[model samples]
Target: MLPDPIHILKTVYGYDAFRGRQAEIVRHVMAGNNAFVLMPTGGGKSLCYQIPALARPGMGLVVSPLIALMADQVAALRQAGVRAAALNSDLPGEERRALWRDIRGGTLDLLYVAPETLLKPDVVDRLATVPLSLIAIDEAHCLSQWGHDFRPSYRQLDALVARFPDTPRMALTATADTPTRAEILAHLNIAESDAFIADFDRPNIRYAIQEKDNPRAQLKRFLMDHEGESGIVYCLSKRRTEETAAWLCAQGYDALAYHGGMDKAAREANQARFQHGEAIIMVATIAFGMGIDKPDVRFVAHIDLPGSIEAYYQETGRAGRDGLPADALMLYGMEDIALRTRFIEESEAPDQRKRMERQKLDSLLGLTETAGCRRQALLSYFGDRCQPCGNCDTCAEPPHLFDGTIAAQKALSCIYRTGERFGQAYVVDVLVGAEDERIASFGHDRLSTYGIGKEHDKRTWRAILRQLIALRLVDVDLSGHGGLSIAEDGRDFLRDKATLMLRVPAAPRPARGKLAHRQASTALPEADRDLFQALREKRMEIARLQNVPPYVIFHDRTLIELAAARPASRADMAAVAGVGEAKLTRYGPAFLAVIAEHGKGLRA
Candidate 1:
């Protein structure tokens, strides 16, 4: 029903093929069927609409939320020789009018606008006259109530579908769980549209959650390990962002800070430095996550725990967008939980919204406390199954757990000896056989078990204390200024009737570069080696233009296989392992063209 899109691959977009279901979605959009795309953060969601916009007869309307993102996407599309323009609040009146004229003149392939602009009756009236082919909604998750970053203006998006009932529509977002997905479809009035859900697992990233104590030192060590690699350090406060960024800079790393507290101009400048790769580290708050298009982020570290798993996932998803190995680390403490809870409780949200926020908070706490595989716990929370990522901190240095029956008794005795009202420092002081003035004043020096654990070092004893708290053997008095008290379980341990396994912390290892690509095969013929690199570069360029991860455009494994087989036709392309009808139809010809070009060069 549509013209062959083969030329799009070579002439305009410069890609040899479509990855995953992109071509199918393109065809579906061109045929005027509504679509809902549930791709990951770095997946090629743009090509679905971009290719169709070029192939179809009329201009495609893309509705996006962020001004910076829309501007960046429009610039990239123009570089690829596609006619695109964005209309938003930031555009001057003359510039906006000119863009509208371009759209009406049939010169623009795609038009991007903010949802607020689309809500104006006058704007909708103008759009009604254009020969619109398709409507694309970016960040569709913002429409869902279950989503962490829900925007009220997004509720008006469904009206666009109503205005042009005959126009095909597609909605896409990176981080949406099943509930959020359902909400997106319901809100958009497209529950029955064809849905494309890509794989949620980002196997290239390793997940880590460490107990918070001296978090700044831990962060420094993490940065030192991954030095020179691009990373983001997330902090809960603006002050912390500035301080951390300054500290990293002092330590001889290229670092910058970004937060809402900074002036608009300064924030923009910092963001530019980061995007251009001039700054390898960005210490920021939640404001930095949504519109960042960087793909080579090697690590995402949380200096403080996020309030929820959704926030954590969305923030960490920024890393490894290139489908390369990345790391996600979280440092947590009792103060973090208290801070998060107080912040939530003081919010002005409705009761229902408050309840939802609490549920999300509980999920994050579970993530921090879980002793199981970090990746499994994370994916399971999002309603997916995943095995332990063998490269994570837990798998790399599996915790050394020892029977804590005796140690638990000693810890409980110390807490009891201190009248169960003192903090950890005092308890540790009493346990380590210290007879300082503070201990002597409270008669803790006279307790029978005061010197029982003196043989172990302070660090070892501290780990035991953490284990006690983690296992609920010791109750942290949340309302009592964080004092330590014996729990019911601690009483049982002291009676010598309970068994415990206390983990001894290991020395942190220097950060090492990720292992070489084990996902690719070594069996490629020597003749095709040059072709392989060419194909990968092409993939990378396409990824850069579309603002997606390289693997989502076309996986490295798929590219390697294509080089080996040298698929020379549509049918040949369809035979590749990951290639399907969507990809073959969208990218087959472009791929054939690349091989043809390379073949001629070799012959010459």
Candidate 2:
């Protein structure tokens, strides 16, 4: 068993050892047992099943959610010299027929198909006649009703358990809380004990949340460090994605816009360019995320707050897939919260689901305002714990805590005095003693609570209100119109004269001018830095010619290792972590030439 998995890992995938629970998972799956894998984005979830498919005697069926994902994975596996192919609508009729023939003939070790395709009875019946090894359901969280990436097609996969009762089955996902995990277990008929939840912390990712003051400027400054790197900028709306992408490009960055609203050709073209080219920034909606397998996305930025912590975690997980240092930044404000709240309120989902969504949103806000470690707070939400990572925004510049009991009382009283039917703007105007027509029309300028908050500017009051909303002391009532109303706790607090503590949002800091700043001297020596860049150039050229992502050729980490070690011969090159026999033979001489030139430089 060790020989099989190790052989597959080193010879096929080019990794010398399994990182986490991957070895255990491969062994369990190969033994023909049911499995439920909850691993991180770059945690090698695919290897758990891919290895078994090779060591096992029958064809492995992978139930994937998207055609693009299937095609991409298939292309990647094929490049590694594996017998893999995807049967999806993207294939022509003849191709599909021929793929089925290959499946029937047992020529393909791995067969990737979408859930809808696999659910067809004829397809199931056809598979029953073939030599079946094991079945894997990728992105299994899509089956959960409460999951952010829910797909009705994944729920239909329950039928596969009954159809392939004798065969081993696996359901894998990267994003699921306790409830969603239970649902996936029940829906997929996997036992509770068989489930594997690997650690959720992507330590290589440094998290930051800015207050969104001058968000465009903040984003521009943030991108200064990550210039000449691949990344994704997530926005709340399609219009924002397009606008941000256009603005970034105009500012001299290569950027692309991707959203569901875009035509297929446009989305595909952008995705391809981002995948194949270096130094590309993709501004996309949540729709552009799930299937992206790029490993060197150095940063991920959110122009707006996401709908849930789950969505935020999943989106940010897209960065630093290769375990290299990366960054995650979000620019959020009170409006982002209010708009996210409105979306949850307007959702046709059941009241219970809406309540859960609101709770999730509040959790995200709590992280933004946390006075402690951001990574610790985020992991705690998922039921994991660790010491302060000292790598996130909060850990860097701790939020200043202020006793806001007086401010809270003032804001809540204003909400109550204003009839709880007005928006925050109106409430703010009344509080700040702005004699506007709306306030005068309502005669609220005469209220006792009016001008009580004049001691604090409108921005200060808004910050207090934002904290109140986050604390559930004030809840946005969306029954008739979007209005600010005191929560049950707000009334209790006022009646009991409770003290409130709030965090002062960090002020926007001036950019360190990282692009102008030299690269960190620690990644490689100054002398080898030039050699590393040459290696990257060669990697990009190979990727473009081969029509694959650059990382597929060699991850940046591997290149860093190559530059540091300057492997002198083919054997030494194979000793590098990512260099397996297939890649070593195909491209070893080319890389060796580059290294030899560096050796010449050193000799000179």
Which residue pairs in candidate 1 have backbone atoms (N, alpha carbon, C) closer than 3 angstroms, thus clashing?
Answer: 24-582
What C-alpha lDDT values do all the predictions have?
A: 0.76, 0.86
After aligning candidate 1 to the native by TM-score, how far in Å is the CA of 348 from where it should be? Answer: 3.9
lDDT of 1 by residue, 1-604 (tens): 6667755755555456777777777787777788899776777788788888788878999988877778667765765556788888888889888988887899998999999988899999999999987889988888887787888898788887678998888898877877788888887777554887776677878887787767777887776557556789999999999999998888889999999999999997777667645227989998886856666677899989796887888889888775666778898765676567666777798888788887787778767656667777778877788777776667665666777778878888778767778877778788889868988887778889788898777777877786677566777666646678898877776776767766666664444434322223233667887787788777667656665445444555567788888877787776675564545565567667777777888999
- Across 322-363, the per-residue lDDT of candidate 2 in tens digits comes to 888788889887778878888888889999998888788878
Off by over 4 Å in 1: 5-7, 225-228, 350-355, 369-372, 404-424, 430-480, 484-502, 513-604
Candidate 2 global lDDT? 0.86
Q: After superposition, how far is residue 574 of candidate 1 from its true place, in Å?
A: 20
What overall lDDT, based on C-alpha atoms, would model 1 receive against the true structure?
A: 0.76
* Residue 511, candidate 2: alpha-carbon lDDT: 68
What TM value does model 1 have?
0.78
Error of 1 at 3 (Å): 3.1
